[model samples]
Target chain A: MELFLLSNGKLSGEAELLGYAKRQLLAMIERRNITSAVFVPYAMIRGDYDQRAGELSQTLGIKVTSIHHAESPAEAIAQAECILVSGGNTWMLNQMLHENGLIVPIQRAVREREVPYVGWSAGCNVATPSIRTTNDMPVRNSVVLPALGLFPVQINPHYIDAHISGHMGETRDERLAEFCAVNPSESVVALREGSLLHVCGNDLRYFSAREQGFKVFRHGAETREYQDTSALRSLVPFTCH
Target chain B: MELFLLSNGKLSGEAELLGYAKRQLLAMIERRNITSAVFVPYAMIRGDYDQRAGELSQTLGIKVTSIHHAESPAEAIAQAECILVSGGNTWMLNQMLHENGLIVPIQRAVREREVPYVGWSAGCNVATPSIRTTNDMPVRNSVVLPALGLFPVQINPHYIDAHISGHMGETRDERLAEFCAVNPSESVVALREGSLLHVCGNDLRYFSAREQGFKVFRHGAETREYQDTSALRSLVPFTCH
Candidate 1:
């Protein structure tokens, strides 16, 4: 099974994280010997398809297709060489995945050595069990999405949740704290902008500008944040096997 | 205790409920012979407050002050002849109520005859204890602003989530099924757009456009939608008390 996951810092015409994102994607391809990849941009609503999909295709120079237009994911899977996912509303993207029952297929594609999957923002989030810990809203409540479980740990892209102290909100720290209270065994990887996480055959690691705490609940123990994912290795005993 | 809960019917605006709300407030006032009321507009974040508040105040034709600007709810309670709340975002409004610790005081004001309180939308929602079974997302989160336990039951407002059956979502019926699965005693009132539930001093009777079912759950019992809240009364046992 070959899989490649690429996460951009941020996207939107305003945020210029694509250069670094391209570097990250190219790095993954070079590492995995991947030739061409299919781009899945489900994070966006069905309305802005042409513009967003068109740009991503032009930007990454890959074949971008809308799974929403296809009769089924099996059809979309048929044409794809490799999978590259763009970032947007995590809940919306998660909802789309759930509404379509594509979780297992995507996992199967990776498992069957069909394609290496690359996911950014929202795509990066649902790689774990649930979408409840993200900074997005349930604008349309399809939040009960099935997880690909590519990573046993919950990846909180835009992990810092910058608006924490200013918005009178449950800060990234507090939200993770609450999540830990509910899901004790769940590990959270708090990726700041520019952080790159690489997963090759169950060996997960993070390469970034800064190393900060990746908090996890220690089974029946309390939640605490540490400097990196490796620290929580003891907590997640069987991540590989 | 003088408490007024503002609700919207299938098509009515919360502001329009002001008239019905005013009548309830008037009766509460006359029963206690009150002369002043404090107006709370904490939920008007996304609306035109100046206009809506004016119409609401004029409809009641009663003097109301915005507790939104108040430093403390005690100040709002002590100053108001009656408390009139407007609607907007529940998460935001609930955050304010929780941050300011107003739930207890508001409940106290109603119980001790200190003031008559009027609540709408988000305001009415937080009147119950657990909003975990809500149809809305915590677009924002707050540790302090838990819902008041005025009612043990959770409400799913604007119930009848998207009518698209094939859509990936837990319908109002499904959410109650989940709710009942754990807390058999938990009763969920699905308030359609036009329903105004008259929850007065331990008595919760429906006053709405249609007679919808109140899904009830009990341990070791079959979960079913009843003809009305009365059918769920056996579940509420306390309403009789």
Candidate 2:
């Protein structure tokens, strides 16, 4: 079983996210011996789902079936060996899941059955317990969608430390600290560009590109900093029960 | 007492948004004798708040007496004539409230004391019963911040009816309808640019600047389309205790 959470798609196929490990991600899928993939994208409503699926198939060198409508989701996953969820409007996607009751079945497929699953941005948010750490706001209460909760900790994909270079004081750091102070039990993993929090079966490691490292704020402990994503993952082991 | 939830500043000046009625906003404020104002901008950093409030003061020609932190928001409202909230990020601002314990007090002020409260973006989301209608994504559990329930419905501010001029089937319309189908009791208000849902002491109205309007939805009922906020005041009286 394998699952990947990406903050965003690599503009040209290069995953430029910190705390995200591309090599690790590839290895996980290889271990599952799964090539057939399903890409669920509700964010891009401008074009047909087939266009996106074809592009993913071309890029990943694997067959990717697109699930645009809810009815197609179950069938798409049935034949697919792995699931890859891309980023878009998390709220809209969650709403779709709740209304359609896909959250539970997906969890079952990924956890109990060990079917490989991957997600980025909104997808990453769904891997956690709640949809609280997402950057998207809840525009309508109609989207009361709970998360899949595969991981106990929250993932901050596209975890940008500074929006721009040489920013000001009370940075995102300050706000993150404030978050930790309020909810000490909940953990926040900040993933920068080209980074990933890798969890292979039972091996969980945090990987990053270059010197970019993400921060981890676990409950009750002093806010600890990491030099790489693997270092953060070392703290938490993903034991599929 | 009065509060004007602004999409931008200069409702009567340069900071005014694209689809709202400037004269109506000014009249609402004038009727309340709002000489002083407090700018609440928890979504943005302190620097952004400072700049936004400066613009509002320059345009309105009113003294921005205090810039209250959400942690101690009531203190800012105590002696103020009006409370104006600016737009930026709702999740971060909501996080600030959770850290500071401001949601309950702000709601209390608006409900009991009649503290005229205005919200834009994040502030607007909190004003409703929940922040379920925002465009932001809480990618993780850490992003779970409590929201204020000033209004019984959710506000999808900066509602993008269409991302591009000619796209697919109505994205915003369909998504909103989907939201209403799930949540039959709560209403969803889509305030396009330059549009607002203005609430004064016992009077709630829809004010529009250009042609843009709001779409309201309730449970098990046909969704209603409103072109002007003013008409809503009479349709739904401020009778909620």
Highest lDDT scorer: 2
Indicate which candidate wins on DockQ: 2
TM-score, model 2 to reference: 0.58
- What digit string (tens of lDDT, one per residue) describes model 2 on residues B75-113? 665555667666655666776666666666666666777
Distance (Å) between predicted and true CA of B172, model 2?
A: 15
Taking the candidates in order, what DockQ does each have? 0.04, 0.17
Which stretches in model 2 have alpha-carbon errors above 4 Å? A11-32, A69-72, A164-171, A219-224, A229-235, A239-241, B6-115, B118-241
Model 1 lDDT per residue over B1-241, tens place: 4344434311433435455344555665667666555766655443465566566566665555566656776767755667766655555566677777777787777666545556665666777675454433343423233477665566655554433321222334544554554455555666554445555666655544445554454445665655545764654534531
Cα lDDT over the full model 1: 0.55
| Per-residue accuracy of model 2 over A71-176 as CA lDDT, tens digit each | 6676566656778776655666776777656677788788777877777777787787766666554544354545887876777665655432211112345555
Q: State which docking tier applies to candidate 1.
A: incorrect
The alpha-carbon lDDT assigned to residue B29 of candidate 2 equals 61
Q: What is the lDDT of residue A30 in candidate 2?
A: 71
